[model samples]
Target: MNKQEIGTFLLRVMLGFTFLMHGLSKFQGGLGNISGWFQSIGIPGFMAYVVGTIELVGGIALIFGLGTRIISVLLIFIMAGAILYVKLPAGFMGNGEGTGFELDLVLMIIALHLGLNGSSFLSIDSKLPNRKRGQVSDKMAS
Candidate 1:
């Protein structure tokens, strides 16, 4: 693969893994704590479940390169909400540090990248059959 393709692959891999970990963490008591924290910050507790589900599902979709653009968009919203509701009040230091916006910022950037570029050539998305007839030429089919 060329440099650009390699870079895209690496970015997808890193973002996929990072998002997956964050989502997995939610199933293991992290979601409850985060939900409580959100409630403490005037956000509803139920929203935590919604966020957790999105992260988990979106992360998995990203890793598998399925519906990448849609998942990326959803994650973008999730990260944006996190920045607004959580990081904003903390003054970017992230709750007591210097602009705790680090994770949110990175996630937002990655999500935006995925939204724009979409899954790389190596992804399952590219390999999937085209829904539109006549789109796949005979040579490509062979």
Candidate 2:
């Protein structure tokens, strides 16, 4: 296997898994509490469900490399929303009661990379029928 492809696959899978867990957590027991928190923060409570759904579906898409580019873009927006609407006020390092946007930033950067570079040859994106050779590839060239 191409090493660059391997690296890209690793990155995508890890990112996907992280989002999946986060989304799953939102539904596991805390969705209502999280929704209430969202409303308390001035956001509509329904947004919690929307965000949770996107994170859950997008996470799965990324994991399978099924919709890497689109999912990555969506994830970027989610991260931006998290940073601007929630984490920014917490301070860069974090507050006594809450964490900060640093993690969101990192996740966004990774999504950005995947958005720009696409999933590599190891991904389902590459193996899909009707895809042109080299149409989807990572730029790492590792």
| TM-score to native of every candidate shown | 0.79, 0.84
Q: For model 2, how does the per-residue alpha-carbon lDDT over 1-142 read when each residue is reduced to its tens digit?
A: 7887788888899899999989998989677988999999888999899889888888988898988999899899989989998899888879987898888999999999899988855577778765466776555453
Clashing pairs in 1: 92-99, 92-100, 93-98, 93-99, 93-100, 94-100
User: Which ranges in model 2 have alpha carbons more than 4 Å from their true place?
Assistant: 130-142
**Residue 21 lDDT in candidate 1:** 82
Tell me the tens digit of each residue's lDDT in model 1 across 21-107.
887788787778978987998889888888788777777777778888888888889888878876777665556554687778888
Counted clashes in each candidate structure? 6, 0
Error of 1 at 11 (Å): 1.3
Off by over 4 Å in 1: 93-99, 132-142
